[model samples]
Target: MRIGLYPGTFDPITHGHIDIIRRASVMVDRLVIGVAINRDKGPLFSLDERVAMLTDECRTLSEQTGVDIVVHPFENLLIDCAQDVGAKIIVRGLRAVADFEYEFQMVGMNRALNDQIETVFLMAEARHQAIASKLVKEIARLGGDVSKFVTPPVHAALRAKFS
Candidate 1:
C-alpha cells in the first residue's frame, strides 16, 4: 500500500488544506497528516487542540473519499516521522514560487536522508492560494472574519484562543 505524508504545523486546518488532502487522497492509499511541532513559531492551538480540529475536519473526507486519514503530532524530524509511518511519498501544496524554493530545499534534504522517498507538490487552487494559517490568524485576531478561509471548527478555535 502506498502511503503519503503531509506534514505541517496546521495550527488550524484550512479549506485549502482540505482541498489538498482531498486531491492527495485520490493518489495515495493512505495519507498521514502530520501536525508538526515547530518550536520557532509559537502555535496558536495546543497539539491536542490541533489534532482534534484536524481529526474533525478529516472525518467528512474520510467518509466521502474513502481515504484512511491519520493525524499524528510529531516533534522529531519530518523524514523520521515519514519513515515511522512507512510513507514513501511526501505530499506538499505549492502556493507560489516562493513556497517551491523552501519546499525544494526540504525535499532535497529528505531525499538525501532517504533516497527511496519522493516529494510531490500539488498546486493550490487559485482561490485558496492566499489562505494561510498565519494570515487567517492575523485577520481573526484583529476581529475580522475568516469563515471563507478555514473550517467552522478552526474558526471557533481561533476565536476562542485569540479573542
Candidate 2:
C-alpha cells in the first residue's frame, strides 16, 4: 500500500490543511497526519487537545470527502514516525516561495535519513495560499473572525484556550 505521512505542528488544523489532505488522499492508500510535539514551540492547544481536535476535524472531512484520515501524535523524529508507520512518502503543502525553500530543505534531510522515502509537495489552493495556523491563531486572539480559516471544533478549542 502507498502510505503517505504529513507532519506538522498543526496548532489548529486549517481549511488549507484539509484541502491538502483531501488532495493528497487521491494519490495514497492512506494518509497519516502526524502532529509533531515540539518542546520549543509553545502552542495554543495542548498535545492531547490538538490530537482530539484533529481527530474530530478529520472525522468531519471523512464524512464530506469519503477519505480515510488517520491522526497521530509524534514526540520522536518525523522520519522515525514515518518508518514506524511504513510510510514511504511524505506530503507537504507549499504556499509560497519561502515555504518552498524551507520544505525543500526538510525534504532533503528526510531523504538523507531515509533514502527510500520520497517527499511530495502540493501547492495550496490559490484562495488558501495565505492561510496558516499561526495566522489563524493571531486573528482569533485579536478577536477577528477566523470562522473561514479553521473548523468549528478548532474555533471552539481556540476560544476556550484564549478565554
lDDT for each residue of candidate 1 in 37-58, tens digit (9 for 90 to 100):
8878898888888899999988
* Candidate that scores best on lDDT: 1
What is the Cα-based lDDT of residue 134 in candidate 2? 92
After superposition, which runs of candidate 1 have C-alpha atoms over 4 Å from their true positions? none
Off by over 4 Å in 2: none
TM-score of each: 0.97, 0.95
User: Which residue window of length 10 is worst by lDDT in model 2?
Assistant: 60-69
How much lDDT does each candidate structure score?
A: 0.91, 0.88
- Report how far off residue 28 is in candidate 1 (Å): 0.9
Clashing pairs in model 2?
Answer: none
lDDT of 2: 0.88
**RMSD in Å for all candidates:** 0.8, 1.2
